[model samples]
Target: MEKSVFEYSHYRSYLRMRLESAGRRGSKAQIATEMGVQATYVSQVLQENAHLSLEQAEAANVFLNHTSQESHFFLLLVQKDRAGTKSLRDYFQTQLDEILKTRMVLTERLGKSTQLDEKDRSWYYSSWIPSAIHIATTIPTLRTVGDLAKAMQLSSEKVMETLERLENIGLVRKEGLQFLPGEQQIRIGKDSHYILKHHTNWRLQAMQSLEHENLKELHYSAVVSLSAKDVDKIKDLLLESLKANVEIIKDSKEEELYCLTMDFFSLLKAQK
Candidate 1:
């Protein structure tokens, strides 16, 4: 008995096995012809020297006659393999396994419950408090109002107020004299109002950072015209990149807190 198609982690290997099982074995040229690509390109992909583009992958999926679920799995395998960073590969691989095991559509799973309560929502949207609390968690010496205020370059009164709010919200717990981060997931629903305010505040802060003379942070901007289809692809890539960064940060051994923010939007309407 052979392994199922879903068991193969590598898309190239899966394609090879799929082709062989379909009685189209030992001929790269045939596969290339089906995919409308050159024989050498197919050879490179099979040899792990190259990868399939999104278009190529979709074409191959069609050629293989994969069902919707199998096609999705194949695309995820390609995404996992083509990921530029290890963190991204790991994240997508995890997602692939979960989807296969649970027999759940990725989009449907993503749309399910992962929301913060009102208190947590309010606590996270305020921004500086969460940052301060995270920093304090890593640096025990920066636990008190005066210490945190001086470290964060804010007034003691403001830090005190934020700390009290965080405590009331159950995001921080007092262990002896030091504050520790609560074991909580800070997830917000897609339609949450806090999402808008959170993004607005960060975008404003990002713009403000440009005016500071001694700023050492990185800021980049680009404007380009793209098809709506390509825009959707870009959005998916951005989301995957964000998730990858979160995974990387979560696995870090040292505590150097930093906020990662990204903003992408259309600046012009498509011409009819």
Candidate 2:
């Protein structure tokens, strides 16, 4: 099945935002004129051109100074646009969420200092199972259900059930009688690693977990922007932020750091 309408729109939206940011001044006219095409071509690419010609894609790379990561992401968008028969975006998005959830668990378990009573610890452990499967498989050679169960001390039955659920939700597959992840699955796995390593549950939950209001004194901050330039800046800023925050936790009362984590979101900025 081709990507869902939502995923298609999102990819297009991302492309459009990147293009617009790259061509900051008169972006529409600049791209159209450079490509020897009409402004509508730029519009069409975002709305209908999922698969881009090499020429068009190259034009984007040249115009955007895209990093290797951005270039690869562009290729993915192009492939999806061409395939038009499978909604690959949905599959990966689901997997990506699961990976982040696992990272969140680890952040709470390993990254923070908290005052979790026995009951809280049990609840935390139970909540982290699904995420554990997601993270465990990321450790190559331990990707299969049995492997994940053994590595994580989870029941095989439970791991298999999670894998089945992931499959039903379009995150995994049985390719040629062997399990395989679709393109999106691979991307999700790759993405989760970075988020888990750098972004902790304290940051992620702080973005959405209003109930943790008491922690506001930590004086944390957020950065948002549409420009890839800003994204780069935010990445650096976050690294500094997390580093400093971690240092503070190490020196503070251990209980205050308990069960804390962080979250990071990198999305195309909406056009002004």
RMSD of each: 24.4, 22.9
| 199: Cα error in model 2, Å | 33
Q: TM-score for all predictions?
A: 0.49, 0.28
Candidate 2's residue-wise lDDT over 1-272, tens digit each?
21221233245666665454532667767766766678877887767653457677667654543333334455555554555345676654554455446645744553343233334333323444544444444344555666667766777667766665443333444321123442223122333333453334435545554644564444355665467787688778988999997798656642221335544665546733
lDDT (tens digit, per residue) of candidate 1 on 59-90: 87656645455678889999999999999999
Alpha-carbon local distance difference test for all models: 0.69, 0.51
Off by over 4 Å in 1: 1-120, 123-141, 213-216, 269-272
Runs in model 2 lying further than 4 Å from the true structure: 1-9, 19-23, 33-36, 49-51, 87-272
